[model samples]
Each structure stands twice: as C-alpha cells, then as structure tokens.
Target chain A: MGGSFTVNHLIYLLQGMMWTVVLSALAFALGGVAGFGVMLMRTARTRLLRQISFVYVQLIQGTPLLIVLFVVYFGLGVVGIELPPLLAAGVSLMVYSSAFLGEIWRGCVEAVPRTQWEASECLALTRWQTLVDVILPQAARIATPPTVGFLVQVMKSTSLASVVGFVELTRAAQVVNNSLFTPFLVFGIAGVLYFALCYPLSRWSRSLERKLNVGRRQAA
Target chain B: MKYNFDFASLQEYWPEFLRGALMTLEMTVIACVFGLVIGVLCAIGRRGKRKWLATLCGAYVEIVRNTPYLIQIFFIFFGLASAGLKLPIFAAAVLTMVFNVGAYTAEIVRAGMDTIHPGQIEAAEALGLSTPQIYWDVILRPSLERVYPSLSGQFVLMMLSSSVTSQISAEELTGVANSVQSESFRSFETFIVVAVLYFGMAMMLKFAFHLFGQAIFPRRRRLGTPL
Candidate 1:
C-alpha cells in the first residue's frame, strides 16, 4: 500500500488481459462451431436428437460455469490424466459457451419466418439445403446481437477460470492484491478493466437488437 | 495409467453437504425476494420523470451489470470494512447478491413495464383510480406477470452464482466442499459431488420458480400461455 502502482504491475495486468482476450476468442471460435452443430440438432427432424440436444443445453445451462471449470480441471486429473490449466479451462469454457450460444442461435433461427421454410419447400429443396441456403442467412442477421451479448458473458465468465488456478485477469488481480494488500484498489482496477472489455459489447448488442427490431417492423 | 478413485471419503460429508445446500438456497431466495423489490423500485425510478434520477438509476444498472459479481462481492465485503462498517460474510454476501441482482432485475422489470400499453394506464385513470392503485393494478402486476419467466430465470442464475460467494468463505456448498477437500485430500471427488449437488439445486430452483409463477400468475396457468 505504501508504494505507488508501477509500470511493471500494469504490464503484468496487461499481459493477463491479453490472455483473457485470447481465451475469449478461443472459446468463441470453438463454441461457435460446436453451437452450430447443437443448433442443427436442436431443430433436427429427429425428435430424439432434439430432445437430447435440448437436454444437453439444459444440463450445461443449469450448472454454474465455475463448477464446470472445477470438474474439468480437477476431475480429469482423478483419471490419471494431467493437463495444463489453460487447456482445461479453455475446453470447459468452450463447452459451456456452446450450449448458451446454441440456445441463442436456435432462437434466432426460429425467429426467421415460417414462409421462408415453406418457400424453400415449394422449391423442392432438401431440409439441409433449405436451412443452408434460405434460413441461415436470415438467422445470421438476427443472431449477431445475442452473439455479441453472449461474448460479454463469456468474457465475464472466464474470470471463473481464476478459481481453478488459471492466471487470467482476475487471478492476476488476486495475486497483486496479496502482494500489495490492496483488496479494494486491485479488485477495483480489475473490475474496471472487465467493465472496459464488456460495456462496449453490451451497448453494441443492445443497439443491434433495436436495429433488427426496426428492420423487422419496416419489413412487416 | 491406472488410477483409483474413491467417492467414499466424500460420502460421509453428506450432512455438511445438506447444510451447505440449504444455505445456498436460503441465500438465493432471500436475495431474490429483496432484490426483486429493489429492482422494481429502481425500474420505476428510472421511468419517473426526473432526468437526473433516471440518469443515476441508469448508471447504477450499467455499472452493476458490467462488472463481475466476484468484484462486487469484494467491493461490498472489503469496501465496507474500510469504511468502518464491518459486516459478517453471510450478510455481506447477501447484500452483494441483492445489489447485483437488483440492478439486473431492474432492467428486466423495466423491459416488462415498457410493454404495458398506454391504454391500460389511461383506462385506470379514467376509472378514477389513485396513482398508487393504478400503479399496483395496471402497471406493476401486469408487468411482473409478463416478465415472470425472465425474473425467475434470473433468480435461478443468482442461486448458481451464489457459489462464487464461497470464494470469500461464506460457508455455502462450494465453501464446504473446499474445506472438505482440503481435509480429506479428495479435491476432485469433493468438487464432483458438489457439482452434482449444484446441478440438482439448479433443477430444483427451476421447478420451484415454475410453481411460484403458477401460483402468482394464476391466469397464466389457466390460459396456458403468456399474454
């Protein structure tokens, strides 16, 4: 508490923030691909597939991401497999994000008009082809806002990785606090950094949602 | 590689586990109840015709919404200590939770309120309803009925996020697990058991919220659909 904040500490925090961004991108990219599969399954013709995928979403959504991080980080070791915390944390985050992203994407896809599906059916397109050619383009527009919003959630959630001893931003703040004994200052700065990362995305998501609603109204 | 796993060590800790589970539920329900009240009030405050008041409420919502709950907990638990108001960890945890969820609930409730038509308020006024009566009958009740699902979901999430309070050693389910794991040297097993418990608790909360919604919004149950 005696010494002022130094460039060294700021650099450490910045490096930690970089990992935060990298982990977020990793989670989003991997989760995006996985969620796409989940979205397909959720709306698949097979009732069982939809039910199973729905269960998947519910199971993942119900549990806290912190617990998921713990299970992956520690449970894997119980089976005599040792992995780096980064890999485990990243995988868990990806899995967790996929379920939520899947749900969001499903909503967006469903929001696309039934007429579009009928039109594709009249054109003799297969369900897969109809989804790919007709429905997805419209769903993509509707999906952007929630997707961005989910990214903020993903970023904030990655802080849970700290509990599993992953040295991300939150963990870095904790480490610095231990040294400086400045709980308020250290965590406050960390919180502000998180706010910096999330606030713009939140604003963008809200604006996109509003704009999309306006577009839907104009089209109507 | 061959590995031996034993959940037996954790099984004996079930009493503690039950107590912890109950604590988690208590914290969540209490926070949800109080937070909902705060949220509705703030939402109403935001809708009030005062520019500065609205701006202040807006800022509160934005700040609380943006920051992580972990930070908010620290700000409450530790921040108040520096200000010479030393509160217990449980109280601090609940307060932080109330403060956190209140803002979120405010925004969601505000969205619900926004959907109420002007005609309804006009009708209430035309009936010579007092301001409080109109607010109660026309605005708040219908608005809450509309957003009941979202509010219930948020409450369930608050229950799940309550696990993070264990970081500050509030003696909740996860905190109990942390202690049991350290004592039993069964970190992985302890966490797995606790994770299952959390999953179970979440399911229970979902069911409870559904029941509560049905009880509160009987019309919804009768109509079998949202308005």
Candidate 2:
C-alpha cells in the first residue's frame, strides 16, 4: 500500500463529491430539455411521432445505463472523435434520464382532466396554446414530486460514471482504497457522503408526494 | 472518418455471450428469490410492535436506498476480502444484489401491506385463524398480489442493474462485453450487441413475470383485479 488514509484523501473525496453534483446537474438540465421534446412527441396528435418516441423510451429504459455509457464513450471514439470523459458521461446520463422523465411527464400530462383540454379547445385556443397555457400548468404540479424523486436516482447514478474513468466520488473512493487498502473505511465515508447528498432530496420528494395527495384528497 | 463496423469478428464469441447471459439470469433469479424473503421479513419487522426493530429496518432501507449499488458492491466485495473472507465474484455479486434489492423490496412490500384494512385483520382474528395463517393468507398474499406489478418492475430493474457487477469482473453479460471488446478492438460493436441482448433479456423477463403473476394470483385472473 502507498500509505494510510489521510486528511488529503478526505479533501480529494470532497472535491469528487462536487463533481458528482455537477454531473447530476448537467444530466438533469440536458435530460429535461430532451425529455420535454419526448413528452411532446409522446402526447402529440401525430401517431408516427408517438410511436417513434415510444420505441425510443422503451429502448433506453430496457437497456442498462452502464451499457449506454459504454456505447457513448466508445461509439464516439469509433468515429475517430475523441471526447472527454465528462462529456461522454453527461451525454449518456442525459439519454438515460430523458426516457424516464419523458414517461413521468407523460403520466402527469395525461392526469390533467380531459375536460380542460375540451374547454381550451372550446375557447378557440390553438393546440399549442391549450397545452402551454392550460394543460402544462396542471401537469407541472403533478410532476414535481416524481421529478424530484427521480433526481435522487440521477444523483446516485452519477457514481457509475466512475467506470468510464471519470474521477467522481465513487472513483475517488476507489483511488483512496487502492493506496490505503482500507476498503471499509474509504467506501464507508464515500457512502456517507452520497447519503448526505441524496437523503435530503429523498425526504423532500416524500413530503411533496404527501402534500400533493393531501391536496388531491381535499379537492375530491 | 471512415469506421466500418466489423461484427463478423464477434460471431465466434456467441457462446461466451450465451454463457454470460445465462449467468446473469441465474444471479437475478437467486437474488430475486432471496431478496423477496428478506424484504418480507424486514417489512414484518418494520410493522411489528418493537420500536428498535422498526428503526433498524427503516435505517437499512434508507441507507441502501441512498447509496449507489456500485459503491455497495465495492464495499461488500472488497471489504469482505480484506476481512480474510474471500468469496467468488458471482457469490459476492449475488450477495450485494440481495442486500440492495432487499431494502427496496421491503419498502414496496410495506407500502402494499399498509393498504390492507385493519378491520380485515380483526375479522381474521375473529375467525380464529392462527398468527401465521393470518399473515400468510390474509395479510401477505393479498399485499403481494396488489404490489406484484411494482415488485416485477423492481426485479427487472435489478436485472439491468446487475450490469454493475461487471466492474468486479463477474463475467456477466457486461463483463463478457468488456473482454470481447478489448480482444476484438471493436468496442462500439461489442457494446451495441450487448445492449440488444440486454433489451431482449428485459423484455423476456417482463413477459415471464406477467405469466408468473397470472399463474399465482387466481383472483387477478378471475376478477380482473388484485384482491
């Protein structure tokens, strides 16, 4: 072994934690944009677009995220394009998250009462206006809790980026353990750091779900 | 930028791929069976009158829920080896998956159990059914039937997540893909094939679960709803 675990190792782990957060944020933002398009296609009037989007979601959802990361990382190189690890990781995560978020938002949109759509159309609002002004506002409320819950999943998944040699929290812990030979200590601390990052979001999502249900119950 | 794909080079490795897929299925089956048992027990513990047991179960669920499976696997595989208790990679992978999925299964089972009305349990008691009888027939069976969809979804996710075990060189589908890619130098094509294999496996698993659910839950088949 190189040496025992030290204060410097802790600092390295903390830095890695920051990268994990950054990667999650990047994935969420990119995925959110792509997922919105996917949701629109899924809910759109065009049967072909809906079918295509459905296949895309099914393909992504059925395969493991690790495989997606490998495909992105190596597929780019196969075309003689050398991208950095962070970009590859971010792209794969974006692809993975979009499928899930698309499905989630689709459910939220469908949850909006059909009468609202009819009323919007009855008022001479165009389809885009009906969706933008009326349906989406209602769907957004139903979508918040599950979206936040999925964020916790996104945060935990960033750990897998380490497989592609992205030196995030899990990779940092592995590096520390390689030198220190203290698997329990190093990974234990890393788990605690992940818990710290994810627990608050999980709790917040649960509270949001509860509050949403209570609101629904009162309305009923 | 002329990169012609060469999947012909990978054709010879189809046997290896099949073996890896078989191992993946084996591991998933073992983990699902044991994980469901652990989950049900923990759910019962969580619902029991003992405060410490409930707290311990809750903590187990939260800790596993919050941490990544990759970290959990690393912790289990390397940590056990360090303690001089070396295990085969397959065994370690299964153990890690059992621990990880057990927590999630417990949460799902607990939620299902919560939907069982309290008056039903009282009716069971009035019928003079024993504790185990009440649990098995009245409480557990219906709860499982209700949450069967969620449980199947988790199991399918567990099968996909098994890809993470490849990190420790477990020789599963992903592990086989890594080796094949390195040897053939066709990384993209190798992973593409593996991705399709995974997609097939996921669909197969879903169909199998649906059939199994239909077989086990007669109430669902007869009434067109879970009881």
TM-score of each: 0.95, 0.98
Off by over 4 Å in 1: B221-227
Fnat for each predicted structure, in order: 0.61, 0.90
Extract clashing residue pairs from model 1: none
Best by DockQ: 2
Clashes of 1: 0
lDDT (tens digit, per residue) of candidate 1 on A31-102: 999999999999898999999999999888888787888788878887877878888888999889889999
The numbered model that scores best in TM-score is 2
Q: With candidate 1 superimposed using the best TM-score fit, by how many Å does residue B214's alpha carbon deviate from the native?
A: 1.5
Q: What C-alpha lDDT, on a 0 to 100 scale, does residue A118 get in candidate 1?
A: 94
* Candidate 2 C-alpha lDDT tens digits along A31-102: 999999999999999999999999999999999999999999999988988989999999999999999999
Question: Chain B vs. true chain B: TM-score for each candidate?
Answer: 0.95, 0.96
Per-residue error (Å), model 1, residue A47: 2.8
Measured against the true chain A, the candidates' chain A TM-scores are: 0.96, 0.99
